[model samples]
Target: MDQNSEVRLEDAGDGAYEIVGTRSGDRLGRVALTGERVTVEVVPAARRRGVATAALREVSRLTLRDRERLELLIPWDNPIALRVALAAGYTREGIRRGTPELLVYSRLASDSGEPAPRLLPDLPGGELSDGVITLRPLGEGDVDFYTELHSVPDVVATSVPAEPKPADEIRRRCSRAATQWLTGSRADLVIVDTATGLPAGEIDLYYQEPPLAQAMIGYSTLPAYRKRGLTTRAAQLLALWVFAETDIVRLVAGALPTNIGSQRVLEKAGFTREAYQRQRLPGPDGGRLDDVQYVLLAGDLLAQASGAGTSHA
Candidate 1:
């Protein structure tokens, strides 16, 4: 069949069908019938199981019961099909070796007595945050607070590249943050001072992949709002929300070695110094500089929160 061959089986009967052959709701695949032929498509992370064969068997039954001829087109060089098709009652009709090679397979649906496969539930979003800071979705109004926070002189001084950015540049950064949040690569929130009804700063939780569930944490505070423990309070609140709301397990933060103030904020927020890397970060003035890494695991935050409660009285 050509690329435009709408070989989807929906028009044949109930519009759509699915076959799930594994417990994880993974190892699942589907087949769509277009006119008289069946097109097989595999689901990711669920491949290699018998999902394809099971789906084909179900489709074959449907075709045979409907008294329609069954046709399937396989790539000429696909070795996997050479084994699966023969085992599943399919026979090689002929081969068309053109610009794009095609190997056609056919099967007879005589009895049409095969049992249909079952479907599975959708994957859950996993654990939501713990309720401390409330890791909610970012909105357009957050741009103003983010812009003002990043423009603060102290924040600029402590940033990887020490130079303060212009208002336009800060706005551009906020715009990018908004895009990232919308795309699901990042989650951001305005740090609202619950008591004052004003935005104090911003917090971002970025998913860094390959490890399944990890994230990087970053925050900034406005100049007039520093030294009053707002950042620390916000961080603590945010950390609680992150652990409770998201599926993330590890949160990492990086800072210049000389920035004791930043380090203190992190420590106060219950993060632990994990490691130090020399010349790993760039200096604000110029050249390369050393950096210290801090990490706060979900367990650590839970422990700290419990400890703080005990000491409060």
Candidate 2:
């Protein structure tokens, strides 16, 4: 539990777990356990300081010590609660079909107290470098370069979906990239040329559902930065990191049938073409597009002659 001496969970009788500050004796929050569900409420004054995460973890420990499972059903719009729930090591099962507004999460005695295996964990310092190309978490600062890349013909043909995203929408996506990393939804990273220290491209790891041991990757290189093998290097670095740092055993990517250049990039990175999936991706004009899937297994990556590289951050 966090904030140990700063705050403590006091059992004020009648099943009420009051979170009180040790210093000022102020009521910070409360953890209520009803049936199999666990709920936490934090006062506005004491928010965002790890109090809620600590309380929820303590409650889960106390409950799981006796039973097998602990549960949390936070509202769909409550991002703060969701963060706390995740920090406290809850697994997001799914949203209830009958109650779509609620996002369901649960903790079990058998579950390791780490972040859910399905959620992508943040990289330390959010960077990876091989002394040449550097990969760092994409941020709002990359909006200009990100928008520029989307304008390239090859990028548009290969990565852009049927309907192009508007400028405002692209900016919004760039802004939310970091938050997505924190939430473990995705890892959006900008590829930087080490010599020039300029944003050269972008890559992302999209977490697949269910068997959390699988993930997919996507990439786009700026027109000015292509033909230098940076995309291939980024893919290799990311695959190495995933295999070394995460349980994801299979990393995959896809490209259009005609995008032989992209296919070759994946090939150079040691990803094997697995299938010619017909109409696997959404297309423009309400149709579907075929994709050639490429895959790299964990054993394949781990057995490679190289390493996950280093972080220059």
Candidate 1 per-residue lDDT over residues 150-195, each given as its tens digit: 6677777666577767776555455454434422356666665555
The global Cα lDDT (0 to 1) of model 1 is: 0.61
**Candidate with the greatest TM-score versus the true structure:** 2
Best by lDDT: 2
Q: Candidate 2, residues 1-313: lDDT per residue as tens digits? A: 4554577898976656999987899999998888889888899999988888878878788878888888888764455777787787898777676644566789999987775543566676768998889999887787788888787776776664755567987887787676566456688899999999999999999876426578899998877777888888899889888888777878989999988889888988888899999988887777889999999997666555565642221
The per-prediction tally of clashing pairs is: 11, 0
TM-score of each: 0.52, 0.73
Cα lDDT over the full model 2: 0.80
Give residue 262's error in model 1 in angstroms.
Answer: 1.8
Off by over 4 Å in 2: 1-5, 10-18, 24-49, 59-83, 95-103, 106-119, 140-145, 167-172, 175-185, 209-212, 302-313
Q: What TM-score does structure 1 among the candidates reach?
A: 0.52
